[model samples]
Target: MTTPQTPILEARALTRSFGNVRALDGADFDIYPGEVVALIGDNGAGKSTMVKALSGSLALDSGEILFNGSPVDLDSPTAAADLGIETVFQDLALAPHLNAAQNMFLGREKPAKGILGRLGFMDAPTMRKESQAALDMLGATVRSLTDPVGAMSGGQQQAIAIARAVAWAKGVVFLDEPTAALGVVQTRNVLDTIRRVADNGVAVVFISHSMPHVMEVADRVQVLRMGKRVATLEAKKTSMEELVGAMTGATVGATS
Candidate 1:
């Protein structure tokens, strides 16, 4: 029998509110290493709020977040990044004018050696080499690493963005609407890359509205309704109708 793995990240009774609007109401989530979990819900279901809280982009009113089974405060985005957690929002967040390699090492640029390093000169060659390796690992194709990212196709740009996050992430990655507006080929490339990332032993929390894509890539589906997790189901064992029912509260009593 296979042993049950402990969750790499866990959220227990997480609660957040904006005035009278409760964004997260005793919500719960967990993800194991090397697993892909899809977080799904309709509008006002608190998917975005959950992502923000877990990514350390938003503060929680009450509840706890655990990393590797130990309580950890995700006080800020930097704090989450320090814990090897990364989030890729829908916008992609790439600098349009920068090349693939440049964007990958943007804020965390490799410095040059000797006095040049102290003088704030970047180590271009090393950054490019590492960036190329990361992209290659994800099987993401970019026509030119030297060319500006803005000139690349939508799929190519998405690939670069994901590769950058995967390169730096050590534990978990949260991707929000990653395949939203891409063409068929581009979406396929991104979905394939997501699988590769999980295969490499990092937990992936994929937030998407596309049931077909979610069912295609996720090992499990987590359904949220009215700011709480109502059900967690095995993707292969559950159908779209079941997932939609859970999201809409039509299917009750499903939990964890």
Candidate 2:
């Protein structure tokens, strides 16, 4: 088994509140480079809250976020992205009408040099090459880069989304419920792609409810319950029964 390395991202004593509800209560989490860490928990268990906080979509009332062992203030999603943190939420957030390359370079489109650059013309060839390279890195087998993403299968679209994150992410990539509504084949494909993403030396935080999926792909599993990080287990060394017990509080003293 491979040992865990130093964390590329860390959240210490993270706390947040939504009026009467305490969404996050001193939650702590971390992920290391070249590792796939699964963040699993029941609904309302602060999984989403933690992801949002890490991705900079939501600020914590109290906590410290660290990147590469140094403290960071992620005031917004843009701030996070500037620091090489990319998040792919459940929505996928792809431009349905656009092709794979177009969607990949949506807001961060490359501009052509010379006169075209001054005219704000996009560098289509460069974008296509980079987008294809990204997909290839993840072992994605999309039919055509020119085809609209909306026309692709769920698995294909998911590959594109993950590839986009992995392409631009210099530090950490967070994926929320990546295979939530995917079919068996699609889920399998996406899971394979996710592993490839990690193999490329990117720190991946995979959020999901699928036990088998997590077990297959993750190096470690972080269990959150009632807004607190209750346990951290090695995926290959831990059993599903033990994981379930930790999540449900059935095994109160369980630790890994």
Candidate 3:
């Protein structure tokens, strides 16, 4: 396949530091549209810092963020989302008290048409319809639209979170440790959901420590060490041992 000409998201020279301890040291990364790019590394490999900078959770001490070929500043999470970049944290951010539709449309509510077509209420019906459609597109197994997210299984919750992002996202989605704490079946379910998201043409920056999972879904893999990108490789061209070595800096690019 030809390499993408326009990266959906790019971070260059990104740096972050706290009390002299640099969490990110000028890491460079990119995610192309409709591609699943794996971000992998050791415990302090700076993957989290890199993503936080992109997600607007953490401001970069230096460097630049580019979205859709334009240099932009993502100073806050809201700013990022406004530009069509969504993040699905490991927590899933579900409210047990809220049903799936409510959870999906939490902050952004549909406008309700009242007298003279003036907005006066929340459009629950449209929210439900759109939420269900998004979930269906993602192949989620949630049978009841009214079911509380808390009542759903881990896999279902994972799917719902992803589906919600897909419903609202127009550019790129950052997934943090998606398969963490999931059972084998749930893991498979989440992976499948991620695949469906990519199929819809949105870029994916998937953060994970699980090498096998990364290999299964990612088209490209980038390894970070001490906040620096050590290597980038085709998922098919690199093995787990080779990636682990690069991530751990065992022998740099080729596992010498």
Candidate 4:
């Protein structure tokens, strides 16, 4: 894939600290339009911290965030969402009792038209239709829209979470461990959905420790170690050994 000249989202010299631990020490990252960039590292290497900072769920001690080439302050998750940036955390965070459509429109439920709307009646049909459209767009399959998300398979639930994020996100979507704890088929389906999302022109920042999955789906791999970015390599050109070396600090250079 040919990389775009400018990034849709970028971080420069980001730093964050938690008491004695420096979670992010001068970290840098960038993702271009319609690209799937994987962020990988060992535990405590600041992968989570870097994601949190970029998603506007955590504030940094010092750094700069550029959206569409202009500096922007991501003070909260709402701020990030308003800017068309969405994150599907590892937890999935679905309402167990709620159906797929209901869960998708949990906090942003649409009201019915006329007096029923004023009386606090939700537009369930519209929400359900849109939810189906979103899932179809991402090539994600759910057994039924009315079925409770908790009753669905892990992969189905994951698809719903991702589709919800992609439905609202116009520029970038950050997915954390999206294919974790799944069967081989489920993992493959999720990865295919990820590629479809990028095909629709959304930049996907995939965070995963699974090297094989990363190599299969990512166009570029960004490695972080000791709270800083150590290497950025093209997935097609780099091997798993090189990625592991970068994560373990055995290699210390950016190939991309």
Which of the numbered candidates is closest to the native, going by highest TM-score? 4
- The TM-score obtained by model 2 is 0.90
How far off is model 4, as Cα RMSD?
Answer: 1.8
Q: Cα-based RMSD of the predictions, in order?
A: 2.0, 2.2, 2.6, 1.8
lDDT tens readout by residue for model 3, 8-121 = 898888889988899998888988888998998999889878888898889778998898889998999899999889988888878888889998998897777766236457
Q: How many backbone clashes does candidate 4 have?
A: 0
Model 2 lDDT tens row, 151-213: 998778888898899889887899898887666766776788778777877888999988998
Among these predictions, the greatest lDDT belongs to 4
lDDT of each: 0.89, 0.88, 0.84, 0.90
Model 3 compared with the native: what TM-score? 0.90
| Clashing residue pair totals per candidate (backbone < 3 A) | 0, 0, 0, 0
The pairs that clash in candidate 3 are none
Candidate 4: global Cα-lDDT? Answer: 0.90
Better of 3 and 4 by TM-score: 4
Q: List the residue pairs that clash in candidate 4.
A: none
Could you tell me which 10 consecutive residues in candidate 4 have the lowest summed lDDT?
A: 181-190
**Model 3: worst 10 consecutive residues (lDDT sum):** 247-256
Displacement of the residue 59 alpha carbon in candidate 2, Å: 1.3
